[model samples]
Target: MDVDDYIGGGSGGGGEALIGMKTVEAPDDGSNCLICLDGGGGGGEKTTTEAWVETPCAHRFHSRCLESWAQVKLGTCPMCRRELTAAAAAATTTAGEDVHVLVADPMVADPLLARWNLFVQRSTDGSRSMSSLVRVLAVSHVLPDEVAAGGAWPPPPPHVVELSFLDNLQVSKAAIQRLFFYDGGSLPPFESVVRSLQSSLAAVLAVFLPLAGKLAYLPEPGDVVIDYSPDAVSPGVKFVEAEYSGSVDDMRRLASDDEHHTEAFLQLVPELEVSMLPAPLLAVQVTRPRDDHAGGGGGAVAVGVAIHHGVADGQSVWQFIKAWAAAARGGSPAGQGLVKLSRVAADVIKGQRTRTFLLRADQIRSLKRRISRRIAAGEPPRETASPVTAYVAIASLVWTSVVRAKPHDAADEAYLMVTADCRRRLRPPIDPGYFGNCVAACYARANVGTLRRGGGDNGGDDEGLARAAAAIGAAIREQLEDPLGGDIEGWLQFHLSLPAARLTAVGSSHRFMAYETDLGWGAPSRVELVSPFARELVMLLGAAGGGVQVSVSLDEAHMDAFETSWFQTAAGDVTV
Candidate 1:
């Protein structure tokens, strides 16, 4: 991780320093530094105390043992492969004491204030240092009252909502970090762009917050607390401008690689530098303005929201955005689309009480064992294969095929899964601020045969595939609209109250996409969810330069065919 990445988010609370821990240092030598330190050594010296040192490699070894060490180390420094380290290892054992606190600017204080309490209650899905390569753009705008009074700047208004993962699946750190790319084009003008975004978002917020009501569930200390002048100890917002001008594929490639993406991305932001964020709950990016004269397609911006999983669900994030937009536009957004959170909760509670269909412990255990055995024996288990459970099944088919199955299955099939947010499906409905994950997984089995043929006009052996994809989309829409198995709240509560062993036994295959990041510029060029979070089929839905952007992952062999089929379907002229 680049240490520089954390500078802006705030770090280094004055405290006791840890001894014997030196900050890992990188060599400043002008040479293109070797990534590894272990391999740099000479053969001439005799004593163990006498060691060979390399510049950027930053490794030292006894001269006599250099060759063997280098051979064994395989070009990496034995201690750490990262090029640089801090001056000293931070030695604080206390969690919050050493944690960096960001000072809120009074200008943005109101916005931060309006949201911080709810922010504290939401879980951030436990993302690591590397979150998204995109950044949130906060615009400075004059409040209506302030403008009326001839004020120069307006106080900020903050808002926060909990994101619930319907089925209680864990969203990994790596998955969240993969949303942005390192090689995308340059950063846009901050103030100028933010002004537009804030304008839009504020209009939305005005409509949303009041309709949603206040967060009824604020934790004791809450997850996020905003202080306009949060003590001098708080770290202020840091800025890093990023800009990149390259072919689409190059940017796409950079976005694909997690390790180098963020840092490499920072290099491109020449104007407003990228700064470290204190566990960002959101990331926004606005691309350079598109030239209307250039042609039909317009340029785009990306917004990514990285909320603590403990907080809200995608639907909640969407709701918040709608509200912000309404508020900014001087009119409330149509609240017709919102799913009442409280009603969802009430419905779930009543359903559970009425159904009396709780699984018996023995039944649960038996089911677990059966699935476990099938998993171990390398067999497809159909017992749990409902449409709601299809994601896991399809994922199993795809993953298993990828790792151990035959050429036909592995070659043809690819993992396919859908992300389901559960705000509307709850029984009585849940509250908007309910801090927990309320998401579900829906999986589809895909292969060249499943998704590439026979759709609309071009029937070049791909109609069947196109038809299948359309059916899959329809199925997803149906499942979500139907509450029976789609009631994510009930499923989540059950899981939450279940035994740990049983919970693990179920082994969910859902993945969360960090798609809500919106900070002004616009939205990302493209967002792809990747590894340690793999499935036979992966589906990502996000707001993009274009309308809602959807990307599905398939095996490399079928990718070309799938892309063709998808585009054909998208064209609207296709029947599939």
Candidate 2:
């Protein structure tokens, strides 16, 4: 079905105005209700006297059954699990406005969360409120083992570092959300794991002090800086505890699937309260499967982290995780870390959904072989320094597939934005352990007709793949030569000027080795980015096995097209 049809307003085709519950006579067709498994005509038995309500998806359920379901399941169809209210709101949203509707089950409440909410109410005095399922605690800095031996009441003061131009560019972007899943077979109880993570996190915060600070705007100088003071209210990072009712296998299945479980994953991560300035820059959540009277000793545990984008990039975040893991294992958290700066850009579009595609090691090798043969034919290689690496091959394949999937004018142009790490490319090379943003954006453009014609070579079915790789490789070579070119301050505006429908942006990289992050129990079975900031963004990460995992976000119709085209052209006979 088309995306519009799936999310359309009502049975009568009226938009948002007509989206509400209305009772009507049951259908004459002898279909059983999904919720009760009885004929829709009545509750106890099939009768014509009962009334039913229909969801946007055209599924009918008895009014009483639907009312009970809504209290626990939120606004979704009982049969298909398709979002009703949220999807309708998204469909009716106007340009230049972003709408994020989250519905929680208010009927279920926890005692700990209730106390936290009361504390926040008295502290903020009506200034702010939080969700019920999330309970927050302030984690203060714990002195390292060596320092604590000397009995120091408090550590030295932290630095007041000014934000760079690159850092400011990300001020409006979404916080990075990543979740790590670990098996609980040989691990301690869930409560013990949480205590260990909190202590280790506090230790690591002492080393990376800026992360424990807030982004404060200076009125006099019109500048923003990392403001850290020893005696500030709620002075430490936000630590959260949550519970997921689903089993370990259920979450694993969702993680490995092609489509993203956005809402479920979002709940796993702690929400970064960014509505106010001087906001907490970091928050961490540890979630476990709800106990079913079975001992809670053997289920999956998920550790979710949310960090402000202005504070760090992908490499920096992983470094922090590794250090924290080391500290949790009773090792030193010390590392060669310093803040570095580089540019990034983001834009907003509505109605986007995320999907992941995996390319096996053999498939990657086959792609490289094909591109290598094409470059050897005197076809001026697309990549300058090293042509046809896994990144180039996979990125090009996605770029071409996306362009093919979407509708475009005959004279339209397609642009691909790729980010390159500038740690080693700078004049005075930045340290590999730098704990901040250090990346530059690169652009590649092609006429829609040329891309559609398989790079205008008409060579074979896979010629488009070769052409796309060349363009991406060449863009990397050119941009790396001068990482900071053009008007730096206009970076965000420059990206906004591009045609949104024909533009695609890539985030993260397979070189980050995300699967290696461990917290003493074992390395994570899977790691995923919750929700990308931009609608057209694509994220790349290293799979636990040997390959690249590519996450793409597009509208429903476009995503369907992309999947069909990608598997047919790129995977070909590969069994992945």
Candidate 3:
């Protein structure tokens, strides 16, 4: 920011520059001034107000330090960082309003004019082939001065909301990818970082104010409501800003195992077409892969979010993406210091394949001390006093290696199901930042001859891993006790008495650290489960070298017997 202090409010003898901004000399550098020490040096001859203002990554700058830093404050390039001119980042914006700057700039003659109705551009490069051109540039709506008064709006109340039993089942979308590395860092212009991410996402929808609301079905209390008005978040949060040419190691090969690389990150989040329902509970996409798309600027920037698993889970979407990345890295909109989980639902099968495995941390402390010494040596009226975590020893070794990778009927029954966290065991306690979906499910059956590995011929694989960690730690302590009586009518009668064949389900809960939801683009190198229809869903996550990543979901004929009965000589790190 130091181009000779850009002082021009009333320019004295040594300052005269901003008075009619003129300084042109852009045509492939020869280095006369590029902004300072001398385009007017002992080489003489330089007038028309010191000329030298070229950008759009052409470098040169001096018409008063590129019109005082790219026309008033950081459109960037104090010394060639490049980026400036989408009509100078849409001519001026400090607080007045509009700041849409979309630039694919093919020598600009229309990259997206006509108020940016759509401005798609994509290229993940394999010689320009990943091509993604999603464009819907602006559709504002961030409300929260508690809007509600166009004459006391329809006697309010009953915008109708309430759907517990873990937000009315049949699981909903919840993908939460977040990569943000600027490898050595320097990304100031993309319309000033999406206008400070649309004003810190309207200051975090005024503290998660019903996530800018929406999610309906109120037809005569047949239930399913979450309206919030302000025209149900006026379709806001669809704030997208994408551009990719490729390179952040080609956008980390789109977290591969290709399901069209997680359907190209579900088209970078924002597809709530639950096939319709006043849907779109929340959505956001901000990406920048770039290595070539005219003026390279790569290294990483991905912030995908898709919500509506009945409105939050995955610890309320990593506490609303770590409070919207601490309000987009400046701060405000916090308080929910993490910890929430359990919301399981399955049945969306179609080919199904989703792999990713790793369990470092001393193999999760040697599978929590061999399932806490087989649940403290079991016997009468429940044996095993304590210690057996890593989520009940990795959901009892992924439900006994997915029932030893398919082989049923020791007279049937396999079931695993699990998931727990009914907010401090229900009966009205909810505020661990009560975002939504309180979660609860338990069922823990087993009997394909005690889960198949060596078909229990008088147990001895440490008594079939402490009898599958005492049936998933007594079905997560009977669905977190405390009068959970009919824990939501026995988890909706154990998913309507599971007849979903061999049954399997364990859910996301690596102690909800979920790759530490660090929005500062430096933690998540991976954490994906793009739910392409949870075929026997598994997903765990916490590993990045520390321990635990599970993820599963088979059906390529039981992914080689569940990767040789859960990763033991099945050719490493596995990805499709």
Candidate 4:
């Protein structure tokens, strides 16, 4: 523990590398100082004046943290175990002065670092995901300090975020992951790698200050808001560093929802505090797999991210993760990875076409009135029918029209799958920024004969048109009243057993919050829901001019019918 034992007490003429010397980059993304994590914005000015260092591998670190780490191992890079080779020592050391010198060459190989596989290549190369055999090394909490907005830290606020109908049903946590591999090169020491990550996280906290807050319910009120006053007690995200002993191929096979994957990589999934309220808005794990022969010099590393449903919705999680990655890469989060969501059966949909249409807000108003007028003639459920909106009206029209156009056998059944946004229906409107799932769905069904808009089976009755709208209203009410949480296994099995063409499910929603993510990499190249576990899905997007863009997938036959009936000559479009 003596100073000389760690630093070098003897005369120092050893041409030693600068102990505190480093290369630094200005933080342009409003990230916290790499060292302090919450040093406030303006990385460019602070990094230069305060002094930062960039490793040969391109990671930036604080000069101070490096000095502290040097006490443990003076000659090797705290991150990658490379010997100090690049820049000359920054400290002014005179011959025979009592100064610690790192004289080792940075390029020299170190077996220990190599055995641990300490270095990771920073590239977005399209490859299989990293392995699942990760060994967790440590878990650290990154806190927030500074920034005028970081308010008081611990025991969040008293305001409760009443769970929307959709949120209550979606209590399930979303598990997402991104894998990175080491570009073919020598690895750095473990300290160097962890140091950069820890510091960069500090910078992120300064901007996204609320993330450090957890989910909790106060005594009598029993409500929830991201309760956090930024004092010492406030909590932040948990960062975990893990190592995998397997190869890239082994990882690809294990990262799915299949039974074989059964909690295999569960450790990668962050745990949330469930109770009065699910706590810890977010948790993350970085997994590094063993060396692989593929990619000349790189091995795989998988970054697992877990976000509590009460804390954030899927879109919000996407935004935060991308931001973190961009900060880590020393650039902005650019390039969206949504294009991979599409898995079209080209052969079946070969000649089919997809189109976008607009529906004016006023036109929807008129349609709503039309349905109400028809309902007035019959003994419709006033409670539900009276409250039906233009959205339900349009969905009814499309659903009935498509069924009429299809060639269904007597035994074949048709259904209109519709989802509702619970945000507006809540007693007291929840905050717009409130996270987590807030959607519920309803199914409106009718006999094939009653659904054909122009088929001879209808006998020219009005059963399919106006009546379908009423059924849609009833279904909406049904969804609201239906008790949640049935046998999930049965529910999943039922959907999977259904034929792809028989059911038309929504793919994406207008509320998906697209085009809002900018993780320093710029806009994503593509945004899409990769194919889901089941068949027959649709994607609904907000289109230009207050219209809704319907992205549907079907065989050539069904596409012809669905497209023809999607937009009638009556309604122009619907508000997204």
Best of the candidates, lDDT: 2
Cα lDDT tens digits, model 3, 1-576, are 222222233321122222222234433222344432234322134422444554434445444434433322224454444334333332332333221221121111111111111211121212124344333344444444234223333324444456655564422333233333233244454556567767776667666656667666553433455676666755555666666545656666665433335445544554443434555567666666555233224355555666666667666777777777687777776655222222221222456666667767766676666555545656212444335676776777777777777756676777788678777777666566666666666777766675554322123344455567677777778667853566443343345445444677877678656666554434555666564434467877675556777777777677678767655422133333
Listing every candidate in turn, what is its Cα RMSD in Å to the true structure after a full C-alpha superposition? 18.2, 15.5, 23.3, 25.0
Q: Which candidate is the best by TM-score?
A: 2
Better of 1 and 3 by TM-score: 1
Q: Which digits, one per residue and each the tens of the lDDT, describe model 1 over residues 129-239?
A: 234333222332222222333343223332333323331133111112233322223334434444555455434422232221222212332222212221211222222
- TM-score for all predictions? 0.37, 0.70, 0.30, 0.40
CA lDDT for candidate 3? 0.52
TM-score of 2: 0.70
**What's the lDDT for candidate 2?**
0.63
Task: Return whichever of 3 and 4 wins on lDDT.
Answer: 3
Decoy 1 TM-score against native: 0.37
Q: For candidate 4, what is the lDDT?
A: 0.44
Q: Whole-model Cα lDDT per candidate?
A: 0.30, 0.63, 0.52, 0.44
What is the lDDT ranking, best to worst? Answer: 2, 3, 4, 1
Tens digits of per-residue lDDT for model 4, 403-432: 655677645666666766555555556544
Segments in model 4 whose C-alpha atoms lie over 4 Å from true places: 1-357, 362-384, 401-406, 422-433, 454-463, 482-501, 507-534, 555-557, 568-576
